[model samples]
Target: MREEPVKTKNANRLRDERRNQKDTRNGGEQTVLTEMDGIKNAISDVLEQLLNAEFKKFVWHLWNGVGADIERIPRAALENADRQDVVDRMVQKYTTNAGTVAVQVLLNINQNDLAKQLEVKLQKASSQRKGSALLITNIRFDKSSQRSGAEIDEENMEWLLGALGYSVEKHTNLSGEEINTAVSNFSKRYEHQCSDSTFVVIMSHGQRIQNKDAILGVHYDPNEHPDDIFFVEDIFSHLNSVSCPALIDKPKVILIQACRGDVCAFRDPTNGSFFINYIVDMFSTSAHKYDIMELFRKIASRMQNDPRFSQSKKLLPCIERTTLVKKFYLFPGLMK
Candidate 1:
């Protein structure tokens, strides 16, 4: 009798453990379902607010980005679908990423207000994240003339990086080799594991060597130390996937404020260089609402109209070596 009671107790414990495991599994699935429902509802709210013609345009734009992919919903499936049906299909096809896709499409249609609303709604569920940045400014050079008004540029950039929630690691007056070493060391920093994005802002006098962009170091001189220049391509290699796995799939924003041609940075006697001033102005005012790319576009547009960059002295800020795979918004003040 005693043996039989022991056996029965063992069997009961085993069955209870299995039941608990099953409940946990079901609970996870239920959480996913709840999240999907929330996305669908939020997306549907925007579609509901749209007029007939606008709704048609929205659908057309959505299909343009999503169609032709085997994993995406077929266009035929959405041809006659209502708002709720379209929402359901998007959620079903893209899962958690559906909200992001919807936001992109909304922005494409000039529905900025709706897109911002949707993004805010989705942001509540995102995990808290941090970022880091490297600001390397070579204001004074050995042979080349000093970067006039670069002090102001450095201050503005540092402030902007902080506002964007990045802990800035700044370096000044480093040689070509030292700059390379700084970047190499920064790439290996453990902070990257916890960071969602990073920035590498290098400001110096630059020249094109055999059609390759090269940023001159503080010790660079044409006659004395001609080789004291860091190639822009090296920066990419240091932070690329093969070298810095920690930053893989995360946004790596590299802003180079060096001239690609013979022209040097134009400085306002009081403020700073034209590039830095415009960047600080645009990002400070509109970063919370617009993504990085849009902010850059606004800056470019401003430059095009400004009296400073006349036909006589053309200074154009160019973006190069872009490897970003997704939209990056500063969302300033969120961390604060």
Candidate 2:
């Protein structure tokens, strides 16, 4: 083969050996390790382990196009891509179909930090329920008031919490000041110092003031006086790790079955409050051994899916600041 004469400018690189490892022998295309390439390598390393068969299974029910995308580009194809484009096709696929599944599946992966955190939460919940207590403040007005069908919720909560093996303290018709005192005194209980967890249920009418959510006592009427309301923050702050050191590492299980603001759902007007109905229905059949959050998730799911309210109303319980430092279980062994 005749050697072709190299141009002077191009020959300088070969003579000086200054051009970085490019050679024309085998269609020379050198891979450069840029900062972005490093990041891509790191991310791909993590994602290769994350987007496994387990994750695909975890979100099979939630994601819309995951199955189709996985089918369109076979796993074998993804495995055979060049280094740079290995994750590129996948990134495009997930972006096009939306990544709701990818994000949610991160929480359930067995070895990921999120799944480990949830495991810690589960550990705190898995202990025996022999010592915990559920304090329920059930306040339905004395016949003269307009709110009805609330007493049914009070009864149902007792039966459910009792079945969970929580020693129940039922307080009826407490005034605003009395509610404060009841909760304040409850926070100082000797049992909390040694108990695994505590459950507080306050069923009443509530309205927000200056954007702060507050629960109303039976005395609250159209006047809306401050004395007749107990701010929800007070409940949380009162039982916080600082105020009540006894509950420092314990789960403060709170369920407020109250109307926040005036957001009312059109119901049968006789069956019951929408939130309570779902709560009772779900808790009645709660799993014998599982996390309390599982029961909570079920209630939220049913509330969103219930035919009557799905279009009109959507309700989710406000779960906050579980500083238990571990997972918890409310394995109330029987459905009483």
Encode model 2's per-residue lDDT on 1-336: one tens digit a residue. Answer: 100111112111111121133333355433212222333444354445554465454433223333443434455545434434544654455442222333334454444664444334333333335444545443464322345545555666666566555778778777677788888888887877667678888876666767877777767654554467788778887888787898876677787766566654222224445565565544444343335677777877766675543464455566666554454655432112
User: How many pairs of residues collide in each model?
Assistant: 0, 10
lDDT, candidate 1, 230-266, per-residue tens: 9999999999898899998888889888777565555
TM-score of each: 0.61, 0.55
- Show the colliding residue pairs in model 2: 120-327, 121-326, 121-327, 122-327, 124-327, 124-328, 125-327, 125-328, 125-329, 164-332
The local distance difference test score of model 1 is 0.72
lDDT of 2: 0.54
Clashing pairs in 1: none
Cα lDDT of all candidates, in order?
A: 0.72, 0.54
For model 1, the stretches where C-alpha displacement exceeds 4 angstroms are: 1-129, 332-336
Give per-residue lDDT, candidate 1, residue 193. Answer: 90
